[model samples]
Target chain A: MTESVITVEHGAVAYDDRPVLRDVSVRITPGEVVAVLGANGSGKSTLVRAILGLVPLNAGRVTLFGTPQRRFRQWWRIGYVPQRLGAGSGVPATVAEVVASGRLARRGVLRPAGGADRRAVAEALQAVGLTERAGDPVVTLSGGQQQRTLIARALAGQPELLVLDEPTAGVDSASQDAFAEALRGFVAGGRTVLLVAHELGPLAPLITRAVVVHEGTIAHDGAVPEPAGHHATPGHEHVHPHAPDESSGLWGS
Target chain B: MSLFQYDFMIRALVGALVIGLTAPALGIYLVQRRMSLIGDGVGHIALTGVGIGLLLDRSPVLMAVLVSAVAAVAIELIRERGRTPGDVALALMFYGGIAGGVMLVGLSGSRSNANLMAYLFGSLTTTSPQDLTVIVVLAVLVLGTMLVLRPALFAISHDEEYARVSGLPVRALNLLLAVTTAVTVTISMRAVGLLLVSALMVVPVATAQLFSRGFLATMLAAMGIGLVAAGSGVWLAGTIDTALGATIVILAIGIFLVVAVGAAARRALVRRRAVPAGTAAAVEPCDVVLEPAPTSPTPALDLDGPDHAAVPR
Candidate 1:
């Protein structure tokens, strides 16, 4: 497709001499919507960190857009929504201020934010439907809204690669759907997404390709096989439901 | 009334003002970072300095400042290296410093028990002219440093990883914060004593947090509360001839309670303003609603078209 956006060849990450990921090799093309499916501590998050150069690679190498991992400047083309942004409960920052901080990288050192930065901040706020509550303290928002505010903060940078670690975790059902829909829109608008998600029931349709991470290595890298023994009948709730049709024997396999 | 008033009351007022203003300013960062308990622990660490000063027959303020700075950096280093958070490290440091100080005091042959007791609490009436100058200089320097590093402060406070990734010197900023905390505790020790320095550090910020909408507002409100507590504490201490340190801390706690109640009341009023989404009563209430937000529809793009590639533009 377009130039390879990310290349991880023989990459390994270890924590305290215990291997978290081993000899993983994956190539992500530009404009691709890739979902990394895995259980907790399956190294999906590690892989994301490896790509972002947050983790030191124990084995081979990772390159982003032709630049070596260390040479790349934080992969500014990539956006990140870490697992814990507001883990500090009483931080006393507003949703808008948090979003505005995303622009700090662009507006360095004592320099004030300009019109474009403010507009981007507002647009990012609107993207996650948090414009109405922009002035509210982030601690006061529900869990899902807080997560969305983080997403909007990422959006403020307008990065091409969006890396989210469990963005929908701890969110309510409706908010989960909202997050999925927002991610789907980002992918559809010619941007790339590398999301780590655990829910296969609802997230299958929103993703374009699958990279299943199991036991610190990629198990499968392809289209998801259809759910076994399932049929979509017209006018039923299962009709065109997010999952693929039966016969591929991939559901819970 | 002038900035240069030289009477004992004016000097005490000025000293208290400087200490009060500086403590909360530095305290905001510690509190925001959730290391507020560290402030309490560090206050005890200052006692070790006092004990050392007495043992060596040195200037208590000088020894206190030196020992406090070293202890502050040690706490940070220990916290950074240890897997446990800064709060736990602070507590450990607190006990360690106090134990060391008590042992040192015991080892000394002099009967300096009264000096130790005064240092344990606080004595603002004994604040020397040199102490005032140090407090004023520390306050001004601390505030100036914060102003210079405002951007880095926001970056670290919001998303430390992102800030580090974007090339801000995260570790250096952290060291700066540690130094600020040390200076704040040392200067404030003159006004509130080591025992209640945390009350001086955290109360004003906690009180301001209730009403502040943003960081600047929070800082402003905290400074105002600190000034009020300092002024009222000095006034009461002068009238009653009681301990100024204890008086300032009590006044700050009182303000904290008032602000906490006001914050609760304001929240209740806002909660009442939230009407049914479709009801006409919503028009008369606040313009904002606190309900969950709706999601947007996913956009569809043609992959086979000329614009198939992902571009930020």
Candidate 2:
């Protein structure tokens, strides 16, 4: 069997002593596209946080490529795109400045970004279909463009693994389509991806496997059986009418 | 030439430069974090410390620095302990510090209320060589910390969680910011006085941000702007014979507004020009097709789409 790129054994997480994720065990092999699904506050983001060492595991071990979460190294090999990238977060940084930040791990301190860094940044932007908007103020971009910029930031790292928490959350339908297309390209390039999402219906077809997180435990983990009645074949698109909208509620229409 | 040649004028210029460079260097982080009031809080806390030292016949500035540093740590610890935001904690500590210093001064009943006024309001004309030396050393230390902590600063600035995920020492960096703020505040107190020091720290960085992109350039621009404001403010104070710190801060604000408006106009002009050059550099030629293999590696998971056919694992 292929060695697991991420190993979580009986992991538990909490905030202020109230448990969020508990005794959860999961193993993700290298190159697998895993989707973590759950309702609101199902501890999905918390689990991702635990795996990335952003949240302390109360009871179990989280190892990324054999290294324990606390000791996880090769930072340049991992990239993250959060749910929201606020443009005016007081940093007053432009899109390029924000994207260049993805190179911090590789650049270390005081060492300036060189020629290769610029190329990677450009390519990442191009991959996200954001080459035209590269110089725009991150704050000035529409919601979709900002999200794409965030994804480009992760891609700039050229990470072996990319973790996204709700990549399409709060994004427009068209932007979501574009984001999905870009992600498909990423996986095609031999990289791995793990994502935590609220509504899995719209993105179900693209997911290789679904791990349902309920009450901090894996409620379901298996290859997603083709959704009952939806047949996705060559030259056909899977349509889920519940395209998420701001007022349509979290689960969607 | 005489302004540069005179001893007192030289001291004022050098003093302004040192404080200008140091306060805003630390202020960049403060402004980014929405902790602009920290300089004010630290200054007040340092005053209480200085009062304590004066009561004990010690170097007031030294006492102030030590006290403020400890207070900075305390503020951080408090912030971490409770769920209160950093700015809220800073305001509380700021008021608490001012009250404590006032009480201490009332109890001690020291001579020369005017001297206290001078320190509180800033008087660059009285800077001693020793004061300049201390400011220089402290400025170097602050700059050194800024350089060493650039990554952490960037992390804290954007996507703090991702920064933590990337294995940045976040807590350590936070503490470093606290200490640096305290030190910078203490040094700036002599130049702008305790009350107006925060204005000096915040205005330069804010003004610099008008024209710059990227973190390093912003800081450089902030330092350059700060120097101009400080020098100009000191000269204005000399001409008008008003409070030096107040003059400096007002001048800094004026400069900030002018730069901000000009920069905004320039950006609008550029955007208008780019309307026609839309195809020039906006979009690249290589983005025609974007399709990666389904059988890619593990870490390349895309959060979008239903194309998960690759990866035998």
Candidate 3:
């Protein structure tokens, strides 16, 4: 850890009149993989979104690299991987083209992408194992591959910190592994990562810290929680260990 | 030389080329933004401008620009409110605009109602020198703005929320697009008429999207298609004694149809050559594919949308 990359103090987000994130405070330092985890409707995504300044804060303040979110214009230093839904949304853009878009913020819209831009794009694609399919239309890729393309698009910017929202959701196991591998390479460069996930799955091992959201507040923060009495099966998928196996119960009582 | 024999023919040809370039040039952005029908909406609003011009004794084209500009801004405002999706807002504005124009035309008590039809059908031999100059200026403005904002526009159109987070001025850029779209619609009304102008804008772009791999490629392809369509349509109309506007739209559509069929055939061929996958993932249950078990007391994180404030990193 070197420098603090993100700081959120008593952050609150509201959708209309209803408060989504009642209160959240998170801080990320350099060379850390911080995972924000919770169940559906727990406001984990909102918390990350609030820090990213994608959602307006109802209360509290957030800073990125010591700059307040509002006046912050240094977007090139931060790379963001939105959910899987961001892929193939509009325009029949190719893998290379979409990846090149990451360079727009760094190079500005007016300047043409030069050698450095192309080099960065190619390197990002290679990191995500997508260099071979760089010429294909994004629409032609599978959901998981599309997700990887987005990750590559983010990585192309060569940001100091990466924020991902459910990057592996809807992705297959293989794709998830690739995402983890690409992220590992990215963070190995002294960068930091902040992500929101329902289940860590393949990403669990990479996480240095975990923050759980429960009812619009931070319920737990520090080491990842495996709930009560849950352990790995060693050779197979880790199953939740419970005495009566009441894990199949529906949500909200 | 023979084709350029008549001065009227020369003017018609010049007008065709202007609309040909501008329509599809702007069309590329409109299509990519999924607001392809915005041309039609603006055109309808231009009709109201024409009616206002007739009543107020002003330049009809200028009036059309003003009216459509206001209309485009109104649409943008509606979009900003996020009360409705773009298509719905455009639809509302479309019918309302035309309705207002029709009433204004009647209320003006002008005997030149037949002349109003000229705006709908377009006159092949009636483009004045003044009209030609206006067309050139309009075309230049549209093209220059597009060139300057090309990258930012592409980012915003691709994903608005992402673009905003990247510190691009999304709202201002969207408004710029709206105003430019209005100018294109009003200017094109002279060559393609209000009813058919959208065809020139949308059809060529749609045709280009069939094979073009990137944004610039698609725009260039669209411009090429538009040039061919406009030139051939005007020539064909002159020879066959038909309406130039309708002819141009029809030609554009014909090209789109050809390209669409070719694209489908290419896709089929590629699919046949590809190897089949081992998994039938589409048949898998939705819960199995997307969700972790709901049983765990650890609350699941929902996928939320992006916020608008620009974050520094």
Candidate 4:
């Protein structure tokens, strides 16, 4: 009977009259680690974006903690780590500075950063095992390190629910292990997590449930789907039948 | 000391000092967002405001602020819509602005091209007490807003989508940034001139970036660079009898080049010292030499074979 952390009922989304997600319904309760899985272009990203109100939904509704997405103002309660991309903009920002920005939601615009904010930033950096590189420019970090910095930024907010899109898509194995460790710590705190990923590698064991998005709708909403046959082997090459075959000739097989 | 004796010189220096502090304060965010030339675009539009004021016999600074604010809002709306690429839209505004300013100035019968030139190239020597007052007020406003909202501004400028999701008012802040940029353009028009204002806004930050590793450091260094450039540019202009705006901008650019070259040379020196050590370590333990065995004959497969010769002959 407790309120769900995230709720989407018949959610639909379109870009330029082209539908990306349709008839997508999902509900995530507190303390659940849910992974939205699908091949590329399956609209898994769009679904999460819609839930975060990053993208407009064409139809249906989304609610965070039972409050409608539009009216929901308690953003400090939710931390979002967007799809992994370069953390640095044109301007140079250190890892700690970037992570400290996450505290803006908790610390209003006018007030200065208090001791609590600094502590949160420090803790977030330590959680991601990036305390050593906290002073380095984000651009100087490796791709995986930058991704960790982003996760650290999200964690700095100390939110109850964390939403991430592909936290380990192109990360190195070491950073992936660090990320998985961080997620384990986050889950141990009895928080909730929802992420969009193509293939959960290190994160596979952390996911309690999986919601498979196929062509914009939920294909499966149950226990994590086990890899079949060869895919079950450790270090086996992960393949998606629905993904475009890059090895096929340019004209396609 | 002698330079500070004259009232006009004192006003000019004071005006430059304010411009020094404010231009780069606002410029850092603009640079972060990759909108370095936004100041120039707003400046051009403000020129049209300057023209309107000349025609109406009202305060040119006030008119410039009003007009540029509207233009800035329009530009922000266009950017938000993303229908037109931001640079293309800005180019259009730039041309439209300068064109409108020229035409309006011509229509204003009493005002001559010389009067407009003062705003164009900046005649800091002629900075009246009233102009100084306006500059200080606007500078305070710009600095105050930047100080108060820096974190939010930095958040949006760094990653707009993340900021939006974080419940920061991205749209409103963007508009405020545009307006703030407009105010900066007008405030700087009397000291650096409208046309070259962007140089002052951009170059100092560019110089600061060479040595600074973080946003706050860059911003602080840029402000310091700007202060030095502005203060010294005025004194140098007075001493050399050069155009104030050009002198200030050139000074800023000069500082940027020095720092850039210094940073590059320092990096090269570090690499030079580290390279030999790294190569020596790599060579000491991993060196492997292989000799071709006497039993391996036919040159490891015959490069002159018919199969190889037939491929492209």
Candidate 5:
């Protein structure tokens, strides 16, 4: 049996006396690209965060690679790309330097980046097709390029599982198509991916399963719905008119 | 040349140089975190420590560090409790410290107002050998902590949630920042005085942020700015016979204004030149895909770190 890379059994999460996710359970096994689809404030981000131990699980349990979430220590195994932050939240960093941060867990602190670290950073940059822009400051890049820089950072760790939160949001279609192409290469290596996106878009073909989150619970879990036409040519003008009422109300046109 | 005629003058210069290097070295973290006023708050708290020292006939700076450290820890704990904004806690401490120090100074049995004033506006020409030794050792220790924990510190400062999920020790690192800020403020009190020390820490770093694109580059530029500001300010103070601490701070601010105004003028010129050609670097980005890079051994599970096991109290 393929080992489950992530498992959240009856997990519940709350923030300041308000429940965000309740009785949420999910299991991501090796090599499956599972997209968590949901409307805004439907607890999708919270679910991923709980599974990764970003938010404290108030009830039930979470386990990473079979170890209890609290005891789970192999951080390098899981690479994560968070949503874009405010422009002011960041110190100006180059694409290479920010991507190199992914290797921090593997190499440890104090020692300078070595040859292996350099090679991984180089490969990650190449994978994202940002090899040419590696020397530019991250802020100088467009939002899509900055998103690619973050993905490259996660890829630099060479993690077994990658968790991304709304990576394609506000990005241009060309960058989206490129990201999809790079993801194909990553999945070819038997890596598992837990993706949180509003619409699969360019990534529709790569998703092996879809888990829809609604109002803090798992609403649907199975094959990708056939009618969304997300597999069409990439363009920001593409709209998901057929998305369920809940998600359409939140993000779809 | 005559400035070197007095050993006291030489000592003051050394103290200013040392404090200048370390204040902004640590200040980069505070500024990135948007906790710019933290140093100011802690400096106020240290004054109470100075007052306590005067009452007990002890080294006021030593007493000030102890008080500031405790206040730093308290600020962190209050922040962790999450009752209000961090600034509220800081403002509370800032005012409480100033008020407490004033009260303590009045209550001090010996009434050594001169010593108290020395810490308020540093006696630049009064640095002793012992003071120099303490400043040097503490400065190295603070800078070393920053260097050794660079990645972890950067990670947490950038995104607390992401760092926590990555198994980085978030709480311990926060506490370490607190300790360092307290120490930085304490050591700097002797060079620029408590009131002006934060300027030494902030202005040079802010100046560097104007154009530097990466963390290390900004840090290096800030250090250079600080060195020039402090070193030149000391000599300028000696040359012109001005107040030493105030002159150093004014020099740092002067450098900031030059950079800020130059950057603004350059931006205006670039817009005029580039707008017609559509050659601006402002293109929208695209989506990212993660499809490959597997087949290696499973990542090691060891989670231990420099301060992982000990939970911050």
Candidate 6:
């Protein structure tokens, strides 16, 4: 059997004395697109955060690329796309500039962006179909385009594993298709993906496995669950019954 | 040009240029992190440091740097804990700072309120040769660090979570920024004054954002605006015999207002010209597809059930 890219054994986490995740274990191997699904307040996001060491786990251990997470220093091997754009922090940063930041890990803080870094940034932008808007300030882009810009930033790092938290939460359909296409290209390179999502829209087909989290534990870990009812209909306006809630736990609170 | 003949005037101008260049250079990151007002809080704390220096007969500039650096780190810690609202923590520092400075200065019998006023409103024309030396050394240090760490600083300020996952050392960078901001405040004490130092740090960046489209462009533009404002303000204050710090701040604000009005007017003009063309490009009607509606409401899938799983490859 191939070694897993990510390993979580009996993982648990809590925020402010309130338990958010408990006794959760997941293993992901290379080239697999795994979806983490759950209702609001179900600790799905916390699970991913725990794996990435964003939040402290109360119990259990997590390893990345066969190395213990705490000892893992090879961050350039992983790309992370956060949930949403933070309005660019009221700063005017061009698309290319933001994407170029992804190379900081590989390029180091003191060194300037070399020729290879520039080419990687440019290629990432092109993969997301944002080459035309490379010169525009990120704040000027639409919501979906901003999302694409973020994806381009993650891609610029050239990581083997990509972890995204709801990359399509508020994106438009066209941009979603573009993102899906970008993911298709990423997976074609034998990369791994683990995402936390409420509803898998354009990205549903690419998912190879599913891990369902219901109240801080993994309820099902196998094949992706097929969408039933309105979700099964094409062009049905992607709306899930789960009202966006405080289930985001540490991040939302 | 006659102002150059005076030794004090030349020193003041040199000091002004240094503060002008460094304030906004470091301020850009603070603005990016939405901590623009942090400089103001640090400035207040530096006042307490100045008071301590006056009491102990130590170099005020060095003392202010030390005290303000400590306070700034405390603020960063408080912000990281997130237990208290950022503004509340700043408020505590603001009141405690001014009060401490006043009380300390009072306790020192040799120094009077006039001495405190020099640091409060600035006495640029009285900048001693030693003060200039300190200013130049500290300014170079600040500028060098900012240049070398621009990428990491920009990444952390723009999106901290992403920077952390990238292994860029977010906490250390944040502390470094806090310390840098403190140094900026202390260095500007002789030119823009502690009270108005934040104006130099924030206003120029705000002014530059009006037209800049990228982070580097904004920083360069803000520094340009700062240099121009500081230089002209010093020159004009010498010519008119006005307060140096107030003059510089007012000049920076004047530039901001002019750019703001100009930007608004240009936007209005563009809108007026585009109105006609915009209407002409209205969307044309397209065919609509109708699908059959299901008679019964479909049951929500039981995601927790293993039976609902997709076929395994």
Per-residue CA lDDT of model 2 for B169-212, tens digit only, reads 66777787888888888888788888888998899988876666
lDDT of 4 by residue, A38-99 (tens): 77777889999999998999999999999999999999999899876434367778889899
Clashes of 4: 0
Least lDDT summed over 10 consecutive residues: which range in candidate 2 chain A?
Answer: A229-238
DockQ of 5: 0.25
Report the lDDT of model 4 for residue A27: 92
Position B127, candidate 2: lDDT: 80
Query: What Cα-based lDDT does every candidate model obtain?
Result: 0.74, 0.75, 0.79, 0.86, 0.80, 0.86
Residue A173 shift from truth in candidate 6, angstroms? 1.1
lDDT of 6 by residue, B159-259 (tens): 98889899888999999999989998998989988899999999999998887778888888898899999999999999998998999999999999998
Residue-by-residue lDDT tens digits, candidate 5, A72-138: 8899898998987433443566688788878887776567788999999999999999998886667
Q: Counting only residues 3 or more apart in sequence or on different chains, how many pairs clash (N, Cα, C under 3 Å) in candidate 3?
A: 8
Please write out the lDDT profile of model 6 over residues A1-253, one tens digit for every residue: 8989999999999898899999998999999999998877789899998999999889999999999999999999999998887644676888999999999978777898889999999999999999988977787788899999999999999999999998998788999999999999999999999999878898999999988887788877888877873243223345453345446664687
Q: What TM-score is obtained for chain B in each of the predicted models? A: 0.81, 0.81, 0.82, 0.88, 0.84, 0.87
Question: Candidates ranked by lDDT, best first?
Answer: 4, 6, 5, 3, 2, 1
lDDT for each residue of candidate 1 in B134-232, tens digit (9 for 90 to 100): 889889999777766665686686677776655566788888788788777877877787778888878898888766656666776787899999988
lDDT of 4: 0.86
Sort every candidate by DockQ, greatest first.
4, 6, 5, 2, 3, 1
Local accuracy of candidate 5 as per-residue lDDT tens digits, B1-313? 8887888888888888878888888888888777777898899999999889888889987898899999988887787666558757678789999888878887885655776677887786887899888888998999888877877777777666666766777898899899889998998898888898789888888988777767777677787888889898889999999878899999999999988887766556544554443322223222211111121111112111111111111
RMSD of each: 10.0, 9.6, 9.8, 10.1, 9.9, 10.5
**Which one wins on TM-score?**
4
Ranking by TM-score: 4, 6, 5, 3, 2, 1
Q: What are the per-residue Cα lDDT tens digits for candidate 3 across B76-179?
A: 88877775486687787888888888777777778667767888767756889899889989899998888777777878888777777677778888898999
Enumerate the candidates' DockQ scores in order: 0.20, 0.25, 0.24, 0.38, 0.25, 0.36
Off by over 4 Å in 5: A86-90, A228-253, B81-85, B109-112, B268-313
